[model samples]
Target: MLKFRELLVQSLLNDKDEGEEIEDEQDVPIPRKNAKSTHIMKKFEGNARQNRKRCISCYDKLQKEKGTKEARAKTKRVMTYCDECDNKPAMCLECFNEKHPSKYF
Candidate 1:
């Protein structure tokens, strides 16, 4: 299966470059596709791999959208698992906050 990042990049590549520069007051074309790709690339440009780590909650949410029973349950419960948490690989934000308020403080 193609990864989401790969798909996004591929889509950006497949899109035609839009716009042309005009010297006068004529409409100047801005390369929206290039700008969009740059915006997305900027999101993943930083170091600190941890920052690049995918959000488990977000992944689970996507899975739920795709109709996974387990993911659905997780969503209905309004929680998500995060490996950074002390216990399980997943835990909802509310539970994490409740359990680790001191850590945050």
Candidate 2:
């Protein structure tokens, strides 16, 4: 079996060759000057399965970085401040929820 480092190198080389092939093919249909090269972002265009796998891999990496076996928090928090209560930059989700209820708004 190929070692991990060799596998990574092979993948990188394959990616470079694929990109070169694409560039060569593009030149055949249109002149380089009139190509109007545009880079379309494809991060959100994958199917559900690809997206789920990517998410799982990212979550695993994050958990390893955090060095915690406990399930990560699902809630998303922003570096925001509560104007009503003294402006604190690191306002957590729980605190924000407790401070502002549905009826308050």
Candidate 3:
């Protein structure tokens, strides 16, 4: 074991003398692509009133057409939710696609 340790130390000394630098695996920086903004659409189950969430885009359109009060009262409710979107907005399939064009179903 002592002989093996001496040989290993000698080899490391030789490598240093030869100007070969040993790189630690953890010290290396990994190359990564720019992070993409993505969203995952999930569906709510059961027929409760709490499950009936309004589609954000539709609600926005309604707000523009009518007003906030009227839009809140009249906007159609959907069962889908986008996890990564702001406020985790509820959206229908079409609205989800329109909002996140880069994401595929």
Candidate 4:
């Protein structure tokens, strides 16, 4: 699999270098293939290795999207996912306030 992946990557890189187009005369509608993946966790709650992947700002933003965070800890329920870093936690306020003080969503 390692060698296979390497070959695939090399082929991709080579393709980028080759500035040529290969097309068929007949128009062909390529059928898109979608595969469903099933994931199972062998161990749950692993040192946040997955969650820690995001920076503090993103973490807070995520919290805001979820409506988890607030401006002041005492007055508002600030988010924890660091919205500023995450893709802007839409529901969490704490994350939004980091960038946009008055976040409506």
Candidate 5:
């Protein structure tokens, strides 16, 4: 068993000395500089609309109606968000309309 191991090691060293390239089992090809990718890269937009967050208007209304403690404990979550607003406050459709009235209208 020892002699067989020694012969295998000697043969591998000899192969390196002979300048023969030893093929790897998983040989991945290196990408060229001018190579065009198959997949198309899409423009990255902001966060998805599906994300739910606590409504700021509803929170304020709750705070005004039932004290800050109760309002904090029972704030409602909504899907609507305003990217234009500072800090991007999440709000319901009614609240969004009320807060941000159309300048054209």
Candidate 6:
């Protein structure tokens, strides 16, 4: 049996995401990008099932970030990912630092 750490190292070196190898003895195969999409879709499904809505802060942030020059409170707050970082819970340092201490980074 592969040791846990060895397995992790193997995964890192494998260069392929484990989620991408969606297959079985049936010889069916799906690439990792599709697998990642499936995973995200499932999470979105669950969120939809719960009728989730953005928090006040998140809603405000969306409005501010997406607002045009006319800048008004938008009735629909569409969830968007950060184009710069694939929206993985990131804040640009220039804006984040004034509010959040550098140590948090």
- How do the predictions measure up, each by TM-score? 0.22, 0.21, 0.55, 0.16, 0.45, 0.19
Residue 9's lDDT within candidate 6 is 79
Clashing pairs in 5: none
lDDT values, one for every candidate: 0.42, 0.39, 0.75, 0.38, 0.63, 0.38
Query: Native-vs-model 5 lDDT?
Result: 0.63
Q: Residue by residue across 25-72, what tens digits does model 4's lDDT show?
A: 344344323211111112223454443333335545456765445422
Q: Which has the greatest lDDT?
A: 3
- Top candidate on TM-score is 3
lDDT of 4 at 101: 42
Please, what are the lDDT tens digits per residue for candidate 5 over residues 1-105? 334454469777774456655444345344433323222222224565546667899899999999999988898877667765667777777777677655443
Q: What is the lDDT of residue 53 in candidate 1?
A: 38
RMSD of 4: 14.9
With a 3 Å backbone cut-off (N, CA, C), the pairs that clash in candidate 2 are none
In candidate 3, which residue pairs get closer than 3 Å at backbone N, Cα or C atoms, i.e. clash? none
Give a tens-digit lDDT track for model 1, residues 9-104.
Answer: 756786534553223423333343332222111122345443333344544665867756555544433223443434434444544454445422
> How much does candidate 4 score in TM-score?
0.16
C-alpha positional error of residue 94 in candidate 6 after TM-score superposition, expressed in Å:
27
Error of 5 at 68 (Å): 2.2
Error of 4 at 8 (Å): 62
Off by over 4 Å in 1: 1-46, 49-51, 67-84, 87-105
What are the per-residue Cα lDDT tens digits for candidate 2 across 1-105? 124454468677775454542333333443333222221112233464543222233335457776444315532333344444432223444444544444423
Candidate 4 local Cα displacement, residue 18, angstroms: 77
